[model samples]
Target: MILWFTIVQIAVACAAGLFCLIAGLIGRRPSDYTVGSLLLVELLLLAQVVIGIVAPLTGNPPTGDLLEFWVYLIAAVLLPIGGIAWALLERGRWSTVVLGVVAISLAIMLWRMQVIWTVQVA
Candidate 1:
């Protein structure tokens, strides 16, 4: 729940989402670009997972409910996996759109997680 890392994650997710949405709107099917962007997002999430685990040990624990933070984090990690699987299996323009939607959704979820980690603790 590092503020700088969370901000980077949000920005990356939004950029990836916008890219996929634009590509889908242009009638592009799921390609390496679309999938790779999502993979990048997924990688960031994985890093976040690790950070979430180690941060508390390093004296940066969340102020909010720990369970709530973990739940949001777990869900955030899953979203990209689900989206990428759907895009690969379906291989359609709509699948790309779905990826975009997932990315945007992930960004929103990350925001909530940040709130729970910092703002809601008090």
Candidate 2:
């Protein structure tokens, strides 16, 4: 919900998404770079979870629908986990692409979360 951190998350997610997408398109399978990028995004999302908790306690509570924000945040966290699982199980270039798509989807979701946190009013 922090604006600057949300921007950072969006940037990182986009970069990771594009990186995985390019790697997949060039006939690459899931590798450390591709998988690690997703892990990095996951870490960021986890950090966001902590921030989401602490931020409200620190008096930066969201002005929007609290339940909607939480749902988006939870979904954002789950997305990368699912993508990584798919990549590991499938072990194919398309799996890498799926990871890319997941990352991109996560970026969009994060953006929506930001809106829900700051723009929408309960």
Candidate 3:
């Protein structure tokens, strides 16, 4: 796991979470902007997955237990998938709520990844 990339993911997740909270407070739905941001985050995670796979192949120690790493990766990817699905099924404040869930889940997964990476390194 690249430290800077992980940091970036954390920052993005926080920003998305904040947006979700604000939208909820204002009683507004998630907009195109929210979806776009989620998509961007997903894309970044996909890139990270590719980099992670390549890194291990190049002789870097695997960042964590392979199964744990894969679980986190799948969860990260699934957040946006869930977000998109919910967005399609609901509108208004409910959409924002769905996004909030996605953001929080992403944050949790990223933190877990960090912890696992640390354990592996140690």
For each candidate, give its TM-score against the true structure. 0.97, 0.97, 0.88
| Candidate 1 colliding pairs | none
Tens digit per residue, CA lDDT, model 3, 1-122: 77788889988887887787678668877788877777777887888788778877777656568788888888788878888788868877878867877887797788788778666754
lDDT values of the candidates?
A: 0.93, 0.93, 0.78
Off by over 4 Å in 2: none
lDDT of 1 at 72: 92
Runs of candidate 3 with Cα error greater than 4 angstroms are none
The candidate 2 region of ten consecutive residues with least summed lDDT is 113-122
RMSD (Å) of each candidate, 1 decimal: 0.9, 0.7, 1.8
Ranking by lDDT: 1, 2, 3
Per-residue CA lDDT of model 1 for 1-122, tens digit only, reads 89999999999999999999999989899999999999999999999999999999999889899999899999999999999999989988999999999999999999999999888845
RMSD of 1: 0.9
